[model samples]
Target chain A: MKLQRVLQYAKTLLSESIDAGDIAIDATAGNGHDTLFLTELVGEKGHVYAFDIQQQAIESTENRLKENGVSHLATVILDGHEHISQHVQQQIGGAIFNLGYLPGANHHVVTKSNTTIEAIEQLLQLLKIGGIIVLVIYHGHEGGKEERDELLKFVSSLPQKYVHVLRYEFLNQKNDPPFIVALEKVKNFPKE
Target chain B: MKLQRVLQYAKTLLSESIDAGDIAIDATAGNGHDTLFLTELVGEKGHVYAFDIQQQAIESTENRLKENGVSHLATVILDGHEHISQHVQQQIGGAIFNLGYLPGANHHVVTKSNTTIEAIEQLLQLLKIGGIIVLVIYHGHEGGKEERDELLKFVSSLPQKYVHVLRYEFLNQKNDPPFIVALEKVKNFPKE
Candidate 1:
C-alpha cells in the first residue's frame, strides 16, 4: 500500500465515537499526510496539535494544509519532543506519529528511540479513556533497528488492563522501512 | 503475543459495534475460537454457520462449543469451500476465517488460495451493507507465501467504493505467525 493509504487507515482505526468533537495530535507531521487526516476527522470545531522538530518539515506541512484548505483547523508547531504537553491541553482523542526523517530531506537527522519513547509517554498521558496512539516506525535507516526493538520492548511491558497494543506490518516484504504500532488507553488507570 | 491473546483480540475486533441479533459466520472453525466468539456475539435468536473441510476440525469445534455451553447456538458443518453459499442464506453481519492449518494438527490439510478466493466471493454476496469479513492469514508455513501474496492481490483488486481492505502485521518480528486482514463492505455495494 502507499504511504498516504497507511495514514488514512491509521486515522480510521484510531477514531472512536467520543472523537466527534475532541482534540487530536500529529506527533510527527512529516509531509502532512497524518496532519491532514487528523484535521479532517476533527472537523472545523475540533482541534489538532501537530509537532515537527525540523523547520522544513513544519513549513512543508503548513504549505500542504494551506493548499488543502485545512490550515485553520490545526496548530502546526515547530518544536521538539518537550513542547507537546504544553501545547496539548485537553484530553486527546488520538495521536499519530510517522517516525523517521523527512522523505527527501534531512535523511541523517532521524528520530531517536529515547526521545520517541519519551514523547510516547507524554502523549499517552494526554489521551483520554478509549483514546488511541498510532506510531509508524521506520526501522530501515541508521539506528533504526535499535529504535524498533526498544519501542517493541516498551509496548510489550505495558500492563494488560491499562492499555492495548497492536503492531501491523507486511512480513513478506524485504526491508522494513516502516510499520504501524498502535496503543489504546483504557479508562480505569490504577492509582500509581 | 500468545495465540490465545491473538484470538481474543480477533474476537474483539469482530464483535465491536455489532448487534446481538445479527448473523455471522466462521469460514474456518479451527479450534472453534472464532465460531464460539460469533455464537456468543449473535446470542439468542441468531445463528452461526461454521465451515471446515476436515471432520476432525468439525468434531473439535463441536466439542469446544459443547464444553463452553454454546453448542445450541452454532452449527458446525464439515464441508468444503463450495458449500458456503448453500448454507449461509441471508446477508450476514460478519464473517471470519483463521486461514492456515489447525494448530498442532496435520499442517498438510491447509486452506488453498483458490478455494479461499471463491469462499470470499460468496461471502461478499452473503454480507449485509456495513458488514465485515475478517481473514487471519498465517504466512509462515509451506504454502503460506502463496496464500498471503495471492490474498493480498485479490483484496487489492476490489473496487474502492465497494470494499475497504486493511492488512495488519508486525514488521519487526521475525517469522511472525499470522496477522489480521479485515474487509468492510460499503453500504453502496451494487445490487446483485
Candidate 2:
C-alpha cells in the first residue's frame, strides 16, 4: 500500500476507540479533511475545534463542514494552534494535525516547529487518559525538512511515563512520503 | 500503551488481512507465540512453516503447538530462517520474523544481519502479490544494535515499485523498544 492509504487506514484504526459526544481537535484544519473525519467520528452531539493560522484554511474548512451538514458540530478558529489550551476549556478525546503547507496553495506557508510543538504540548495537557494525537508529517517541500526534523526530536524527547509515541513511516518512498507520529496518553503512569 | 502491548495490537491488526487456507511462515519461532498465532490464522486447510535455529526453540514451539491442538497445521523446521526459500516451495501469503535471541535462552545467540536479509530477500521473491511480511525487531541486546542498523539499511534500499515498507517504532522509550518493519508487495505497482 502507498503511504497515503496506510495513513488513512491508521487514522481509521485509531479513531475506533472514540465515541459520540466526545470532543476532538483538528490542530491544522487545512481544507477540513481531518475536521470532517473527526466530526463524523464524534457524531452530532460531539464538538470539534478546528484551528488554522491562515484565513484561507479556516474559510475552506468552514465551507467544507457546511457542505457536509455538520457545521454546527465544529468551531473553526482563525488562529495559530499554539493557543489551543486557551481556546479549548474541556478535555479533548483526540487531536489530528496535518503538518506542511496546505495542498494547492503557496508552499511557503507551512507549519513551523515552535508553534507546532507548543500546540502539541498544550493538547497533551488537555488530552484525557487513553486519548490519542495523530500528526501526519510531510517533509519534502521547502522548509518542511526542518519542521519534520525538529518535530521528530521534540516528540522523541517526550516522557514515556505520560505518553507513548509511535512513528509509522514508509522507508522506500521517494521525495519523502508523509509519515504519521501517533501519541496515546497513558492511563496509568509511573506505575507501569 | 507499553511497547509490548502496542506490538500485540499491531499483530492483531496485521492478522486481519490474512484469511483461512492461506500459506504463512514463522521465520523465527521463538517460544512459538507468533507461530501459534499464524497457525490459528491459517486454519486447518492452510499450513504454516515455522523455523528456528535453536533446538530449544523448536521443542518449545512444538510443545506449544501440541498444547494448542494446532500441531497438525504447522511444519516446524529445525533450522535457521535463512533457509526459508529452500524449505518453503509454495507461494506464501504472509511471514513473521522476530529478530532477537529467544527469551529464556542464552542471549548471545541472536539473529544475524546477513542471514536475516537473505531470508527476507528470498521470501520477497516467493511471496505472492499483496503478501505481507512483519518483522518485530529487538535491538536492545548484545550484538543487536549492529544487526538492527544493517537490517534497516537493507530494507530502506528496497525498490519501491515492487514493495512498500513501513517502520513502526516508539520514539520515547528506554532500552530502545523493539519496532515493527512491515513490507507488503504492491498489488498494482507502477500504475499507482
- The lDDT per prediction is 0.78, 0.85
Clashing pairs in 2: none
In model 1, the clashing pairs are A168-B169, A169-B169
> Which interface RMSD does candidate 1 score?
8.9
Poorly placed runs, candidate 1 (over 4 Å): A1-95, A98-192, B1-6
DockQ of every predicted complex: 0.13, 0.58
TM-score of every model versus the real structure: 0.62, 0.92
Which lDDT value does model 1 have at B79? Answer: 91
Cα lDDT of model 2 by residue, A1-192, tens digit: 423365685576447545688999999999998899899989988999999988899999999999999999999999999999889989888888889999878888989999999999888888888888888898888888899999999999988888888887889888888888888888534421
Report the Cα RMSD per candidate. Answer: 7.8, 3.1
lDDT of each residue in A1-192, candidate 1, tens digit only: 221255455666765522657798888887888788888788888888888888888998999899999889999998876568877767888888777788989789888788888888887787787777888888888888888898889987777566767776543344564667878776546656
Find the number of clashing residue pairs for candidate 1: 2
TM-score of chain A of 1: 0.91
